[model samples]
Target: MFYSSSWSKCLICLIFITSGNAECPKPQVEGNFVLTNDALLKNDFPEGTEATFECANGYLKEQGSERITCTSGEWSTLELTCKKKDCGAPRKIAHLTYEFGEEGTLFGASAKAICDKGYQLMGSSYRQCYANGWSGRPRCEVVTCEKPIEIKNGTITEQPDKEFPEYGGVIQYSCDEGYTLIGNKSIECNEDGEYNSVPPECKDGNDIPLKPTTTISTTSITTTTTSTVPPIIRDVDDIPLKPTTTISTTSITTTTTSTVPPIIRVSGRNNGIGEHDTNAATGNAAVVGSVIGTVIVTLIVLFTLYRFYKRKGSYQTGEDPSRKEELLQFKNN
Candidate 1:
């Protein structure tokens, strides 16, 4: 009985040692990490057991082993570490700029795009980072304006052959001869595909009329007369007869004439003088004729006075009736 009891104690001691050596301490896993391909969920694991590690959901393994093993009643050091997954920088877009959210470019992070001036954004404005990469890239496009319509009697100064105009482009206008511009001379294309100002038009210059021409003329005449006594003739018969009276006349004349051209005045209608324009020339000629008649009368009076003075001696002898009658007739003629 003593030997059997000693053997039973030894057996109990051996079993305790074997059980202690078979189990290993629990492995420590970082937060957000899990053991992959492990079937045993108990706190302790058997020696020589192995397991791999992996990060959950949005996390990725970083700078650590992906596997662990149990040995000598203890677990191998848990070197597995996990970090948040990153999608890197956002994709580049033309004419577009991006802003990041608090999560930055990491997994599930959000970013938004803003288009520059004179540009429009296409597709969604916001994008999110995923395991694959950033979501579908948003794009920016330049704004355009429609082609400008042609103006009447005018032409566009620049880029006339282009089918469409870009934002902020300018269009200038000009009018042809005999036409006037009636509105703004230039217009600019806007972001909404429309012009900033209305188009200009050309108006006819002949809408207003001209006035008729008028002419005027004036004439003035002045005449001056003087009387002079002629030399007397006496008869020899001692009878004092009344000296044959002789009369001499001198005349002077002055004439003034003026001619005026037709003056044109602008009014509501167009008018002109046709036949009436000759009247001014006719009046000027009449003034010249009157001046010539006065000069002839003055010359005739001077010649008659000189003849009477020379014949005075012959008339002093005897007066013959027939001769006197003949002399009177000749002087009258």
Candidate 2:
């Protein structure tokens, strides 16, 4: 029993010596480490030690080496990664939207902003997408076409004021009689969201001419008469039964009748029972008619005589009885 006890004591001593000799020394912890971002450097750790990494709030570790066992008092070559706050690329816009500020940004990216129609985006238009949630609170602003409100003589030619991204455009208008325009006559789009000038005025009016004018009147009179005159004699047998002579004469007279208006002046007598008064209207008409008739009668008589002489051969051949028969028939017809 005493011997067994001594052996046990010896074994205990041997165990303690072996344990002391085999123990791994505390890792040297020599390699420099970066606490910032938990990013590991090229020489971050040594082969014989262990290492741990951590990231700041709003940050995360991309690669972790929280604990590494030491081999030969050195850690295996390793790396730790701390990710900077990652703002995801701007989200896919739900509706078609324009960018007024920087785009394609990172977690801390910021930019001026605006909404589509009707509403506007407020807050420091510029904002960041962060791990701490979207940076600036975005509020919807009301869009309006206020001030100088009415277009005056003109109407809105295009869409009125509306919420839009920075640099969004606008249009205005005016109207006038007898005139028109096709395209937008005036337009403005600025970073400030206000129009630059008012719409233009249309051209003025012009006059045209009228139709023509004139006046006048006229009158005429006609009369007919009958007369007796002989045809030319072609033969002796054509002897006439009566004188082939016409007598005509004319006279003038003025008369005033009670029926005549006082506005017209009248003169002479209207009595019809006396010898033609040199001043009687009837006597005058008769005298003139007689004169004309006498002239015509004289011409007829002369013509007949010449024809008679020609048929009778009174000048050159003395006379021809058969020819006279022919002349007589001619005169009768």
Candidate with top lDDT is 1
Off by over 4 Å in 2: 1-15, 18-67, 70-88, 94-148, 151-189, 199-333
Task: Give the root-mean-square deviation of each candidate in angstroms.
Answer: 21.8, 23.9
Report the C-alpha lDDT of model 2 over 192-254, residue by residue, as the tens digit: 456555555443222112122211112121222333344444435434333345543323222
Cα lDDT tens digits, model 1, 1-333, are 999999999999999889867866666666878776463466557788776778877788787887777787767876777788999887677789989989989999989989988788899999888877888778988777777879887787775355777777888898776566788988887777678989988766555344555443434444444444434444553333555556654454555545454544322213332232445555556656655665666666557757865665543446677877776677669
Error of 1 at 102 (Å): 2.3
Reference-based TM-score, model 2 = 0.29
Candidate 2: residue 291 Cα off by (Å): 73
Clashing pairs in 1: none
The residue-level lDDT of candidate 1 at 41 comes to 63
Tell me how candidate 1 scores on lDDT. 0.71
